[model samples]
Target: SLLVTSGPPDSSLQIWQVVPEDSADVIKCVSAIATENCTGQPWAKIATISARAPWVLHGSRLNSVRITDVESRKNVYVAGSSSSQELSGLAFLDCDTLLLCCAEGQLCLADVRHPQILLEAAPIPS
Candidate 1:
């Protein structure tokens, strides 16, 4: 198993590998990457690991989101929302599809293959 974590104050994301010990699980840092320096919030607020792909999607309290390749330990894509709302949630619908939610109740669907174009977006009802 793998675990994804973000460090506050310091802009960094780390991936850990879970190893099965005799009676407990031991985790070791497998890979890490530095995130973009957001002026206010330098740490990731939301993160999700893909089940169908070796990809990790994370976003800070800003409008930008990053996609990292676990196997290569490199950033594969970076996208930013046109809206100024802060990111609230992150998830993977499939290997290629991603779901993102904003603090202002907006939901966005994006395709990993084409990170620039948003597939769909709508406001969620209160």
Candidate 2:
């Protein structure tokens, strides 16, 4: 299974499943999460991650990442970002470790199991 997040001025998160069919790889969208509610409220940023089972992390426009459970459809963890930091990319380094890049030139290493930032790096100004 794979999770993807995308938007252009607005964002959405989706989960996909990779299957083998006819000796080829086929990707299918299994779940589409609403980044906005009925009132048109934004829920996530343009970056997302599929951590361990049931734990899906979504970036928000408000400089924070929200961790939600696919099974319960509830929030589990919320990782806060700086005011100048907006999530630009997300990658899983391991089962519990994640790498997050920000638009403001910050690289953050976070733990998926808990709401803690293990490491962070910011680009030096020229």
Candidate 3:
């Protein structure tokens, strides 16, 4: 079972519903969505976000998306990328904090509960 980020402007994310049978290598995609943006490259890194409520965040590089967290009642979007670097990693530090690492060694922290509040931390040279 994998929640992978999809591409294009249609399906920004997809839950690679992997249903494993008896065989260890036998994995099946039970269901899948369409594409949305970002050249449709499946991102390798995936993570689940919990912000006082459960949130499903998924997307690829340069994909402007809007996710509605029904539990917390917040609209989350991909932070605008001012640089050429793409996102390399994503993690939820806590219920309200999210950490994003860019390919250009830029690390960012944001408040998941509030999309407008973000912090541009120090960059790590790659």
Candidate 4:
């Protein structure tokens, strides 16, 4: 199994591999990648791993969502641009689709292949 984590203080994302040991399962960090254009900003408040692909999605306080390729140890795409709304959660609908939840009660569906296009968006009823 693999795990992805974000470091707000370091402004980086890390990928960890879990290895079975005799005594206990050992978790080791396999890769670490620095977040671009986010030197002073927090990296991620919410994150999600893709079930069908070697990808990880992270949402930061800057109202941006970034997708990282674990195998390449690099950012493959920035899913959405910055906005007034803050990200509250992130999930992978599929290998190419993502669900973004915002603090202002907006839910968005974005495609990984087309970062600029919003497949769908709606407000969460209060």
Candidate 5:
């Protein structure tokens, strides 16, 4: 399982492993740097090693991204613009699926089945 983290920079997201409860050390197992703009509230989900990473950036509007577990400790998922629009609210349908509402009235479902596959990128009309 992973710990989802949001808020720090303007639009940032990250994840860390849930260390065993017995450990007295506070060492973080994993951390993800935001590659894209998540310009608002950040969302995260925990799946198996086969599970995907689904996150949301919320503010003026909602934007979200879905990423598969092709690589470990990689935050290859991002959603929304870092400009005036803000995103918030996040949920996952399954290990390979994600759901969220954008402030721009956009409802999205991203498939994290394959990271190498080219996905259709289009802004949902407000």
Candidate 6:
């Protein structure tokens, strides 16, 4: 868990929590700090949990990634899936539903509360 990071050298750092072993695909929480001028500042939860190659698509490279939380639905948004060997190929799907990574490869990003386990990384098709 990354909490309260300081400057370039980051003098002030604290240990938040330890990730367990059973967690296959665990999304960690991130908090943001206020500016120096703010006397009484509060840390806000910035983004939901995401991982390496979080946004995946067939025959594409991901250009951008964004997350949205609304009353109707909460989702993880991604964009720029136009390259195969590129990490910026694929864009975000409509919502956080079961993703079709390849012809025989199935990548399902389960719900935030009940996340699906990612056993392996699908090889980007040529």
Specify the highest-lDDT model's number: 1
Model 4 lDDT on a 0 to 1 scale:
0.70
By the lDDT metric, which is better: model 3 or model 6? 3
Estimate, for each residue in 64-102, the C-alpha lDDT of model 4 and write its tens digit: 677877787667768656574666777887778878777
* Sort by TM-score, top down from the best: 1, 4, 2, 3, 5, 6
Q: Specify the highest-TM-score model's number.
A: 1
Report the lDDT tens digits of candidate 3 across residue range 25-110.
55444434333344555453446665444455543442332343534435555554444345677777876666777666667777
lDDT at position 12, candidate 6:
18
lDDT of 2 by residue, 1-77 (tens): 56554444345566677888998999987866555322344445443444455566666432456666766667776
Give the clashing pairs for model 1: none
Ranking by lDDT: 1, 4, 2, 3, 5, 6
The window of 10 residues in a row where model 4 has the poorest summed lDDT is 37-46
lDDT of 5: 0.44
Per-candidate TM equals 0.76, 0.57, 0.56, 0.75, 0.45, 0.19
Residue 114 of model 5: what lDDT? 51
Report the CA-based lDDT of candidate 6 relative to the real structure: 0.29
What overall lDDT goes with each candidate model? 0.72, 0.60, 0.53, 0.70, 0.44, 0.29
Off by over 4 Å in 5: 18-29, 38-64, 68-71, 75-85, 113-126
Worst 10 residues of 6 by lDDT: 56-65
Clashing pairs in 3: 7-36, 7-37, 8-36, 8-37, 9-36, 9-37, 10-36, 11-35, 11-36
Model 6, 4-115: lDDT tens digits are: 2322222212223345668564544343222121222221112222343222222121221223332212243432233222221222334343232322443423232233
**What are the per-residue Cα lDDT tens digits for candidate 1 across 40-113?**
67467545665656777887643568788877777777774565567777787777777887776677888778
Give the least accurate 10-residue stretch of model 2, judged by summed lDDT.
36-45
- Point out the higher-scoring one by TM-score: 1 or 6: 1
